[model samples]
Target: MGTLYYGDAASPIEIEDRALAHVKVVIATKLRRGESFTLSWAHGEGQEPGRSTVWLHPSIPLRFAFTEAEPALLSRAWIEELATSANSSGGLMIVPEPERGGETGPR
Candidate 1:
């Protein structure tokens, strides 16, 4: 698992390491362009069954920590899909990546 620490929040948002790796790329591109938007995710059914949205701004501090020692491979198709969502009026919506064997793209 990986954790994304945003702003001054003490508790970090937990996500699968591979998923977080891909999300980081999309977020970095947006921030690099001085763009700000919301990133929303639904709480897992095992825990709170609600959704939460976070405002992603250049001013806020963001950190990504991965549990696995090695970095997972990344996919360009997934990044592009995420970029499309980020560019939409509704902002970025976090979704799970496709299955490992079924996924294909750049490293």
Candidate 2:
């Protein structure tokens, strides 16, 4: 059981095989560009709070143990669901996908 330490609290987040891919892509992109950020989530109603300032690095392997369980990406529909959830959840700390077709700024 891998542990996700957030803020001053810690919990074990279950990561399935599929979700690991998205996590790897997100983390790798941020680390590759020498960016650092925080991932925060409220585990329960009034827990001690949860957050982690991950210092992503390129050498980090895309392994299950290093990723968090975000089951929202199980399918295309789920991906769209997650996108909506992320936007509503104050936006997650992820490397923004590059703009396309002359679009400017981060997506």
Candidate 3:
């Protein structure tokens, strides 16, 4: 698991390392372009059964912490999907990573 520290929130958001890597890429790209958006995800196991959303802005302090020393391999297709959501009116909603080395159905 990985931790996403956004702003000065007392509790960091926990996300799987692979998914977090993809999210990091999209977020950095948007922030670099001075764009702000919302990032939302359904709570995983061991947490309350609900969802959470955060406003991401360039001015806010953000950090990604992974248990592994090195970064995970990123998926271009998944990144594109996330980017598409980021550009949507509803903002970015974290979706499961696509299966590797297999044909995926339409989004």
Candidate 4:
């Protein structure tokens, strides 16, 4: 599991390491360009069933912590999908990566 620490929130958002890695890339790109957006996601199993949204801004403190010692291989299609969401009016919805065959791109 990975933990995303946003600002000074007492509870860190926990996510799977692979998904969180991809999310980190997309977030960094948007924040670097001074773009602001909301990130929405459905809560994972074992907790209260609900959805959550967080407003992401360039000035806010955000950190991604992974449990793995080495970085996981990223999927290009997934990254593009996330980037598209980041540009949308509804903001970035953290959906699972779409399935594709033999296709990979740079991280």
Ten-residue region with minimum lDDT total, candidate 4: 98-107
**Highest-lDDT candidate:** 3
Among all windows of 10 consecutive residues in model 1, the one with the lowest summed lDDT is 98-107
My TM-score estimates for the predictions, one after another, are: 0.86, 0.35, 0.92, 0.92
Summarize candidate 3's per-residue lDDT along 19-92 as a digit string, tens digits: 89889989999999999999999999999999999999999999999987777777888888999999999899
CA-lDDT, candidates in order: 0.82, 0.40, 0.89, 0.88
Ranking by lDDT: 3, 4, 1, 2
lDDT of 2 at 39: 42
Question: Rank order by TM-score, top first?
Answer: 4, 3, 1, 2
**Angstrom error at residue 73, model 4:** 0.7
Q: Name the better of 2 and 3 by TM-score.
A: 3
Compose the digit string of candidate 1's lDDT tens values, residues 6-107.
999866888788888888888999999999999887775566788888999999999989998887778766777788998998788888765455454434
lDDT of 3: 0.89
Better of 3 and 4 by lDDT: 3
RMSD of model 1 against the true structure: 2.4
Model 1 segments beyond 4 Å from truth? 99-107
For residues 1-107, what per-residue lDDT tens digits would candidate 4 score against the true structure? 99999999988999999889888999999999999999988899997999999999999999999999788778888888999998999988888878854444435
